[model samples]
Target: MAVSNVYYTNMRTTLQENLLQKLERLVRKAGMMDMDFENKFTAIKIHFGEPGNLAYLRPNYSKVLVDLIRSKGGRPFLTDCNTLYVGRRKNALDHLDAAYENGYNPFCTGCHMIIADGLKGTDEVLVPIDGEYVKEAKIGRALMDADIVISLTHFKGHESTGFGGALKNLGMGGGSRAGKMEMHNAGKPFVNQELCVGCGSCKKNCAHGAITIEDRKASIDVNKCVGCGRCIGACPVDAVDSMCDEANDILNKKIAEYTWAVLKDRPHFHVSLVVDVSPNCDCHSENDAAIVPNVGIFASFDPVALDMACVDAVNRQPVINGSYLAEQEHCHHDHFKDTHPDTNWETCIDHGVKLGLGNREYNLITI
Candidate 1:
């Protein structure tokens, strides 16, 4: 594997070219414009930032890409799959409302917004791939339907995967409800007996006869449970929950495989903004203070190299005083690891390399 080219530009901006202009210049210099996007349906995959999270990428940045793609005769739309967790983004209606509240309305992004997994988060296309962990990946239907995939990620620290970069955006973010269950857990969802109020919602919605209710408590039969994750979404009182017991390293590898499934046989591009540098993922409604100062924008054809560059850039920055990373023990040396001791981000990068997703060794071309 040769060194992939990862283009970068610092946060410095003159009066003439603002950050938006710099972003346009950066991606253009990185060769995104060279793709034959004419009349193609382009899916700009992004995290709209959990409702209260203020660290997400601004919709204005997306408008730059939207406008540029339109200039090339490409039809672009800002998109993200519904989250599996019980949150503002768990269903398409709630998810779109959250996106609109977070400033991702069509007027702001210069494009439409699509909840890739549809209303209930069950609309998906199963894609088979040969990998160590995942054999078949359930990807969001709208995401797979796009002619081109583009990950516009907020490069920030994540407690689960060490960091949420391109792989997290495309892999974990691309999965439908069931696909997320496969990545996050080894088995089906279990009912919290204490919280289960004899509600039959889970039982009624279960396509498989895996759920049983007795004595005002619901129980799940592992043998019959197919892990479709419908129960998790159907439980109105949030009594159902995924086991979520997958090891972080294995979770990273599965994420790599899912990303492969999304990008394989498609012309894909990546962009990561290392601005917030939060201690946890944006899935949290409340974002923590910045661990490190802001790095600039990164773009590449190689998602692996793009993540590598973003993490590398973050590692070089000095920690901010009073931030969560500053309070933690820094024996790990790497910023992400120091922030999240249990997580190993390298697993995703390595697995991506093994799956021929992209190269870890990158030439950082500063624009």
Candidate 2:
């Protein structure tokens, strides 16, 4: 059966009048509220931007969605798994602090924040998937256990994936920290001898004892490395970095497969806010300049269709001067591909379609 995607940009009057009101209308138009929600737990997968990142989706938008879910007799909670790289969100304690600091408090979004991977980032469910890159996907237990899943993605450019849309949000954002490592890298983390200051910070911070220093430089024992990503953040000089040996196409296909694991059997809905329009993901503590002006909010039953529609919409918009994409002559092409020449965002959508996750073809209706 073919899936349908519904879209609505952010052109309404106000948050009270425009954004919030539009969310209600979009949910209805997408028929998301048509599902049975009485006394059921609905997990709203979202990225609570890392601390110092100011480009995250506004808490106001979450309130709109949360209110709508509640009105349908569903209990909704904002949730995200721990990140692969060490930061404010590598563990549940710090992760929750980062979330609350970013104004994801219940008072602000009208929903509690839950770290899906648990305190140590080990509470996970291993889902078997036959894919080129991944055999089993490590997903957060709470998300895997949810009655329904909703992804509220902040659509933007990504240095790795061309763009972080619904697929990236579900595949990368939904994984356990270890799961993210599996999807992002071909192997474990490595240390740059030049950047190591012999600070011992990496070793001390490493919970797995995967790192060791010799002659004031750090080295990673892949055998011992758990791929936890803590040493990556501990290096002051940015010496430790992710291994990019994973093929981009394989990454995209694996992402689709992982997303399938996350939402295959559950009632799933996706929404994306195309504001900020940063040239990189909100995962960065510092967001780069917007490559394009704010597009709008989008909602759909099919994540792939929604993402494809968003890329098309951005490509149609006039490129902003002085942005990262301004100098590119082919800015008229797929906006994400134009910005990231090596990445193919369509791979995710196509693979999603293949995985029975969603459809790539969509009907865009302006609201």
In lDDT terms, how accurate is model 2? Answer: 0.83
Give per-residue CA lDDT, model 1, range 1-367, as digits (tens): 7899999998998989999999999999999999989999999999998988999999999999999999999999999998888799988999999999999998888899999999888899999997899999999999999999998999999999999999999999999999999999874889999899987999998988999999989999999999988887788888998899999999999999999999999999999999988999999999999999999999999999999999999999999999999999989889999999999999999999999999989999998
The candidate that wins on lDDT is: 1
Model 2 lDDT tens row, 1-367:
5547567756547645766787778777877888888878999999999889999987888888888889889999999987766578877888999998998899999989999988766678999887656788989998988899999999899877889999999888888766777787764878878767888988998887788788888898999887766676556666877775787887888888889889887888899888888888888899877889888888898888898888877877877889888866584367787888888877888888878887777888776
* Highest-TM-score candidate: 1
TM-score of each: 0.99, 0.88
- Least accurate 10 contiguous residues by lDDT in model 1: 229-238
Model 1, position 46, has a per-residue lDDT of 95
Each prediction's total of clashing residue pairs, residues at least 3 apart in sequence or on different chains, is 0, 2
Question: After superposition, which runs of candidate 1 have C-alpha atoms over 4 Å from their true positions?
Answer: none
